[model samples]
Target: MPRVTIKEIARRAGVSKGAVSYALNGQPGVSDATRARVLKVAEELEWVPNRAARMLSAARSETFGLVLARTAKTLSEEPFYMGFIGGVESVLSTKGYALTIQVVPDLETEMAAYRKWSAERRVDAVIVVDLRVDDPRVPLLQKLELPALVVGDKSLAGGLTCVWTDSTTAMTEAVEHIAELGHQRIARVAGPPEHGHVWMRGQAFAAAADRLGLTGTVVHTDFSGDEGASVTRQLMTSGPDRPTAVIYDNDLMAVAGLGVIHELGLAVPDDVTIIAWDDSTLCRITHPTLSAMSHDVVEYGGRVAHHLFELLDGAEPAAHLNSTPKLQIRGSSGPPPA
Candidate 1:
C-alpha cells in the first residue's frame, strides 16, 4: 500500500487539513472529539510519520554523512584522510551507499550540518569523529534517533557504538622505544587537548616516561606542519634540559620537524630522534624514513564503517577495540648522541 498522506486522513476523518495537522501533531487547535476522530482515521488508513517512510519502504536514503571540523588546509594535506576514505568507500560501495562529506569550520557548524541532514532526510546514518570529553553531539544525535558510528574511545562516545584504537599503548610504546635507545628527555607535539585521543596519548606518554625514569612534556598544536616546525625549533633551541627525543602526532608534522632539524644543522637519531604517530607513505619516503607507531589506517577506517553498518541493521554493537599501533623502528630513531 502507498504511504497515507495527511490529505487522505483529513478526507477520511471529515476534518480540514489544518485540523488534521493539529490532531496528528497534538496541537491544541483541534477539539478532543476531532482529535480522536482524526487519529482513528489515521490508524484505519495506516498513516505513519514521514520519518518512518524509509523504514516501512525498506529503502535506505543510500547516503551516509560525515561532517568534519577541520580546516580545508588540513583536509587537503592530510594523507590519513585519503586512506581512511578509501577504506570507507570500499565498504560503502559494495553496499550501494554513497558517502557525503562536509567540511565545517568548528563544532557548531558540524552540529548544524547534522541537524540539516536529519531534517532534510539527506542521510540514513552518519559517522562522527574527533570526539571530545563531554561531547554535545552525543545527546543531540541520540535525540534525533540518527544512527551514528563514533570513531574514538567510548570515553567520549556517550554510549554509542564505537571503533577505537589503543592510542595509550601506542604512545607508551613510542616512549619506551626511545628510552631503550638512550633518549633521556622527550617531548610530544600533540594535537589539540580537547580531543579525547590526544589527551589519552598525552597521559600515556607521561606515564610511560615516569615508569622509565625519563623526562616528558607535551605542547599542543593544531596538527599543522608549520606549527610542528615552529614548536620543534623552540624546543630544540631551549634550555640545557631540552628533550633529546620528540614525538609528533602525525607524519606531516614529523616531516616538518625533520626540515627544521636539517636547517639547524642537527642530525636525526643523533642530535634528536623523532617518532611519528601515523605511519604513512610519507613516513617511508622521507629522507631519514621516520620511525613511527604503525597501523593500517585504511583497514582501521574500514572496520569503523563496518560497525556503522551493523548499527544500521539494529544491532546495538558493543564498543570495538581495533588494535594498538606497533612501533616500527627506522633510520630516524636511535640512541641519543654521546
Candidate 2:
C-alpha cells in the first residue's frame, strides 16, 4: 500500500493542503472543528508522519547509534555486548528514543557508518566502544562534528565525553590475588592488543607481576572460545614450564580454557587456576565456577548512555570513572599444587 499523503488527507477532508497541514501540526490558523475533522480524516486514512519530514521540522532524530567493528559470530557469542545493549535500552526506552546498531568487519567500515549516519542525520548521537591507541575514530568523529561518547579511558577518548572502568586497577588486583595465592608463574590470555583497554590492562599486568616478582607472560587472541582453548592447550603442553595461574580477558575464553584443562586431566586449583573478566553468568555455571573480575556491565552501559544524553543536553565533554571491577573469588582459583 502507498503512503497516505497530506494532500490526500486534505482532499478527503474537503480542505486546502495548507489547512490540513495547520490542523495536523496544531497551528493556530485552523479552527478546532476543522482540526478535528482533518485529524479524523487522517486517522481514517491511516496516515503517519514521514521520519525525514519530522526530522526536518524538529531537527531531532530521537535516536542513537552504535557500530561494532566485530564479526557477527563474535557479537552473537559475546555476553558483554548483550548486557551492555540491554543497559543502553533500559535508558533509551524511557526517553522515547531508539538505538540503531550495525556490525562491521573493520574500522574503515565502521567509519563509513559514522559518515553515513552524519550525512543522513540518522542518529542524535553515537556510542563508540573498543578504543585503540591513537584511535582514528576520535579525529573522524570530530571532523564530522557528530555528538559522541567514548566508552574508554580519558587518554583514549581524545577530549570526547567518556565513561570508563579502572581496568588497570582491576588487573593489578587480579595479579596480586594470584600472587598471594602462591602462584609465581602467571599468564594472561588477552584480547586483541590494539584495543585501548586491553593495552592498558596488559601494561598493568606486567607492572604488577614485576612488583610482586612473579614471572609473567601474555598471549593475545580474538577473545574467542576456540582461540582461548588453543592458547590454554599450548601453555599447558609447553614442556613442563606452564603458568600455574591464568587470567582471561573475557568469560567465554575462561570457560573454554577450563574445558581444555579438564581434558588434559588437570584438576582446578591443583594443576592450574583460572580467572575471567566481565563476570558474566557463564562464570557461575562452569564446573568449578571461575574466579572473575566482577563488575556490572549493564550499569556500565547505562552510564555511557546517560553521558551521551548529558552531552546532547549541551553539557561539557568530560570523563567519568564508573567503578573498578573487583575480584570475585570462586572454586577455580587457589594456591598452586604443593
Candidate 3:
C-alpha cells in the first residue's frame, strides 16, 4: 500500500496543493467549503499529514515555553509550582502542545535562554513568572514579538496579558485578622523582595499594620524551611516586644516557623499565632493545622494555558483573571493576652 500526501489530496479534491496545505494546517487561506471538501476526501483516503513537515512548511513551533528564573531543583521541590505547572500541562496536553521548560540560575541566564529559544523559533509562546515592578521582561518580550502571559502584577504595562492573584488584598486581610484577634506586634517571613508578588504582600502587611496602629516588621528569606526557622528565631529573640503573630510567604517556611516556636518553648496560637500564604496540604497536616489564604493553583494554571492558546489562535488575549484568595481559619489563630 502506498502512503498518501497533501499533493495527492489536492489532486483528488480538485484544489491547489497550497489550498490543501492551508486547510490541513488549519491556517486561514482556503474558504470553509473548500477546507471541508479537502478534509473529507483526505479522511476517506486515510491520508495523515506529516506534522513535522507541516510545522516546518508553515513555520509553527507548536510548543509553549516556560522559562523559570529559578533552579530545576527548586522548582521540583516547591509544591506551589508543582501543582501550578501540572495544571498548565493539563490544558496544553489536550491541545496537542508540549511544554518546553527551562530553569536558569538568574534573570540574566533566563533572559538569555528566552532569546536563544525565541531566535531559533523553538517555541510558539512563553509564560513569564516572577515579574517585578517595572519588569524588564515585559518590554523585552514585546520586542521579541513573543506572545506572553505574565503571572504576576496586573499593574504591569506594555501590552503583556496579566494573570495574577490578589496577594496584596490577602495580606492586608490576614494582618487585619491577626490584629483583630488582639495581636499587636506582627512579623512577616517573606520571599525575596524582588518577586513582585512577595513585594506586594509585604507592602500590604506593612500598610495594614500602619493603618491599624500596630508594629509590623518583616524578614525576607529564600522560601526555605531552614531559612524560615532561622528567621523566626531571629525575630523572636531580637526584640523587646516579641511579635504575637507571624505571616509566612510559603507553607514550607510556616512549617519551619512552627519548629522554631516549639524549640523556643512557645505554643502555637497561645504564644504566637501563625499564618501563611501559598496555602497547600502541608498546612493541614501540621501539629496545629495552619490558618492560611487559599487559592486554586491548579485552576489558575489551566486558565493561563487557556489564555496562551487564545493568543496562539491570533486573538488578543482576554482581560486578566485575578484569583481571589480566601482566609481559611484553622487551629493556628486565637485571641492574644487579655
Candidate 4:
C-alpha cells in the first residue's frame, strides 16, 4: 500500500492543494465546511500527517514564548510568576517542548518580541500575561495569526482563549471579611489601574465597602515593594482617619506594607489588618503571618500552559475559569481595635 499525500487528498476532495494544506495544518484559509469536507475525504483515504514533513511545512518551533514587561529582579522576587513558570515548565518539559522567556522593560518591547517571535517562528505559540484594559496585544496576536493563551479575563483578551482566576469574588470576600472585623476605614493597595484584574479588584473593593457601610479608599501602585511601602506610609500618617486595614494586590506589596506598618509603630491585626493576594511564601514568612487570598498559583500556571497546548491541538477559543481564591485568615487579620 502506498502512503497518502496531500495531493491525493486534494484531488479526491476536489479542492485545491492549497486548501487541503490549510485544512490539514489547521490554518485559517479554508472555511470550516470546506475543512470538514477535506478532513472527511482525507479520513476516507486513511491519511496520516507526516510529522517531520508537517513540522517543516507548518514551521513548528516546538517552543512557546512568554515575555514579561518587568526587570529580571522583579521576576525573581515575584512568587506567583515563579511558581507559574515552574508549573508551565513541568508540562512543557514533559511534552518535549521548550519555553523561551524574555524580560522586557515596556509594552513596546514586549510587542516587538511578539512580532519577532511570530515572524521568525521562534515559538509555535505564546502565553500572554498581565493583560491591560483594551489590551492591544490581543488584536496584534490575532493579526499575526499566532496561537495565544491569554491568562486573563475574556473581556480583557478580546476573543482570545482565557484561563482566568475570578479576582472580583476574591476582592469582595476580602472586603466583606474586613468589614465584619469592624474595620471602618479600609485602604486597598492595588496594582496599576490600567491592568484589568487590578481594576476589577478595585471595583469589587469599592462596591463591597459601599454596601458594608465602610470607608474605602483604593490606592493604585505599580506592584512594587517601594511603592507599596510608600503608599502604606502615606496612608498611615497622612491624617488621623488612617485606614485600619489594607488589602494588597500581590504578596510582595503586602509584605512591604507589613514592614511599613511596623515602622510607623503600628502592629499587624491589632492596629492595622493586612490581606495579601496569591498567598505566596512571603505571606507565610511575615511576622504575624499575612492573611491572604489563597490559590494554587503553580497549578494556575499549569492550567494556562495546558490550555495553550489545547489551542495548538485545535481547541476552540473560550473562557476557562480556574480555581477561585479563598480568604485564608491568619495572624495578620483579627477583630479591629476596640
Candidate 5:
C-alpha cells in the first residue's frame, strides 16, 4: 500500500499542506477545530508519520538495536532469545519505540552493524549481549560514543551500564542441588567458553564440585541441539566411569541430550540425570520434564530494557543485579542409580 502523505490528508480535509502540517504537529498555527478535522482525515487515510523524517527533525529515532552474533539455525532453535526479545518488545511497544535486530554470523559483522547504526543515527541506543572477556565490542561501542547497555556481569561491562544475573551463584546452587541427590560425577555441556556468562558458570561449577568432593567435567558447544546430542553420546560412552548427572547451558541442548540418553538405552534420573539452564516451555513439556536453573527470562529482558531507557534518560552508568536462577527440580533429576 502507498504511504499516506500530508498533501493527501490536506486534499481530503479541504486544507492547505501547511495547515495540515500545523494541525498534525499540534502547532499553535492550527485551531482546535482544524486539528480535529485533520486528525479525522489522517485516521480515515490510515496515515502515519515518516519515521526517518521524524528522526531528522526531532534528532531522536526512538529505536533500540540488538545484534546477535550467532547462526540462524541455533537462534531459531534456542528459546532464550525468543523470550528475551518478547520481553524487550513488551516494553518498547508500550513506549511507542521500535527494536532493530540484526543477526550476523560473527563478531566482525556484528561490530559493523553497531558502527552503521551509530553513524546513521538509526537507533537511540543498543543492547550488547554474549559479552566475552576483553570484548572488542565494548571498546568499539565506547569509541563510537554509542549509547549502549551491556547484558553481562559488571566485570565484563568495562564500566558500561549493565544488567546481569549472578551466574556464579546460580551455578553453585545448581551443582549443590545435584550433589545433594548423591550424584558424585557431574558434567556440564556449556556454550562457547568465550562468553562471559559461560566462563563464569564453568568456574563456579568447578569450584562447587571441588568444594563438594565431586568429579566435574566441562565440554563446550555452540549451544546447538546437534552438538548437545553428540557431546552427550561422547560423555556417556567415552569410559566406564561416566558422569551420572549432566548440566546443559540451554533448554534446546538439554532436550537434545535427553533424546541421546534415551537412544543410548539409559533412563533419566535412574541412570543419568539432566539439568538445563533457562526453564523454557521445552523444559516443562519433555517426556521427563527437565530440572533447570529457573529465572523469569522474559522479566530479565524487560529489566535490561528498563535500564537502557534509564540510561537514555540521563541516568548514571551502573550495574543492576537481576535475580539468580534457582534450581527447579522436576522429573529429570533425582538420586543416581543404585
Candidate 6:
C-alpha cells in the first residue's frame, strides 16, 4: 500500500483537511474529540509531515555546506574529521536540515567548491574549519557576504563568527598537571604551527610551563601518528635530560607514543607519564589507559549548528566559545617516581 496522506486521514476521521492540519499542528479551532480522531487516524496510517514541501513553501533551502581542505583519499585515513562530521550531521538531522559535504585538495579547489555551492544556492550557510593564520577564506567569505562560521580563532571577527575550544587553557592545564606530578621537563607533540589553535596552544604551553617554574619544548608535526612516534623516539633517545612527561595535541599521536615508550623499555607513570588532548576510546583501550584533557565533541558540533542558525536569522553578532577541557586521570599519569 502507498503511504497514507493527511487527506485520507481527514476523510476517514470525517473531518476537513484544514481540521486535520489544525489537529496535526496542535493548533486550536478543532474540537478535542475531532482532533483526537484525526490524530488517531494519522497515527494508524503512519503519516509523516512533508519537510521538503514545508521548506520549499517558506522559500528556504534548509541546508548547510561544509568544504574539506584535504583530498578524499586523505580524509578516510583521518578519524578526527569523520567523528566531527558525524556529530555535525546528527544535529542537522534533528533540525530537519541537510548537510552538503565536499572534499577538495587545496585552497583553490576548496574555493571552487564554495563557488559551486553558492552559485547553485545549495546551502543556507557554510562552516569553515582548520583555520590558519591569515587564511585566504577570510577575505573570500567577506567578499561573498556569505553566512559563515569558522571553527578556529582567526582574525575574522568583522567578517565571520567563530567557534573555538580553549586549546590554550587546555594545554596550560595539561602542562601544569604534569608539573604537579613533579615533572620538571615537558615536551608536546603539537599540530602544525600555521593553524590558529596549534599556535595558541603552543604559546600557552610555554607560558604555563614558565608560570609553573618548569622547562617546555614543542615539536610541530602534521598531526599524524607516524610523526608522533618519530618525534617521541627522537626526543627520548637523544637527550641528557629528556622530558619525563609528554603532552600530545591529539589521541592518535598519544597512542603512538605509548608504543614508543614500551619499545624503549620505559614504564609509564614510572619513567615517563603521558597526557593527551582530545580524549577518545583509543586511550582507554591501551595497555595502560591514557590520561587526557577531555571535551564533548558531539556538543561542540551542536554548538556550531546553533550559532549558524543564529547567523541565518540576520543576527549581526560575534560569538566565541572557550570550552574548558577537564583532566581525566587514568593509568597513564601519576606522581614522579621516587
Q: Compare the candidates by TM-score and give the number of the best one.
A: 2
Model 4's number of clashes is 0
TM-score of each model, in listed order = 0.82, 0.98, 0.83, 0.83, 0.91, 0.78
How big is the positional error of residue 55 in model 2, measured in Å on the Cα after superposition?
3.0
Give candidate 5 regions above 4 Å deviation: 1-50
Residue-level lDDT of model 3, residues 243-317, one tens digit each, is: 888988988889889988999988898888999777888889998999988888888889999988888888775
| CA deviation > 4 Å runs, candidate 4 | 1-56
In candidate 5, position 336 carries an lDDT of: 93
State the local distance difference test value for candidate 4.
0.90
lDDT of 4 by residue, 54-105 (tens): 6667657889999998778778788888999999998898899999999999
Give me the overall lDDT of model 1.
0.88
Clashing pairs in 1: none
State the C-alpha lDDT per candidate.
0.88, 0.93, 0.85, 0.90, 0.93, 0.82
Global Cα lDDT for candidate 6 = 0.82
Q: Say which prediction, candidate 3 or candidate 5, comes out ahead on TM-score.
A: 5
**What ranges in model 1 sit over 4 Å off?**
1-58
lDDT of candidate 5 over 1-338, digit per residue (tens)? 47989989999999999999999888889888889999999998888888778777757888999999998775578899999998898899889999998899899999999999998999999999999999999999999989999999999999999999999999999999999999999999999999999999999999999999999999999999999999999999978799999999999999999999999999997999899998999999998999999998899889988988998999999999999999999999889988
Across 246-335, the per-residue lDDT of candidate 1 in tens digits comes to 999988899999999999898987889999977989999988889998989899888877888888889975789987889999999878
For candidate 6, list the clashing residue pairs, or say none.
none
lDDT of 6 by residue, 135-253 (tens): 88878877876688989873534457888777777887788789888888888899889888888888899899989998788899888788889999998896778988999988888
* CA-RMSD of model 5: 2.4
Clashing pairs in 5: none
Off by over 4 Å in 2: none
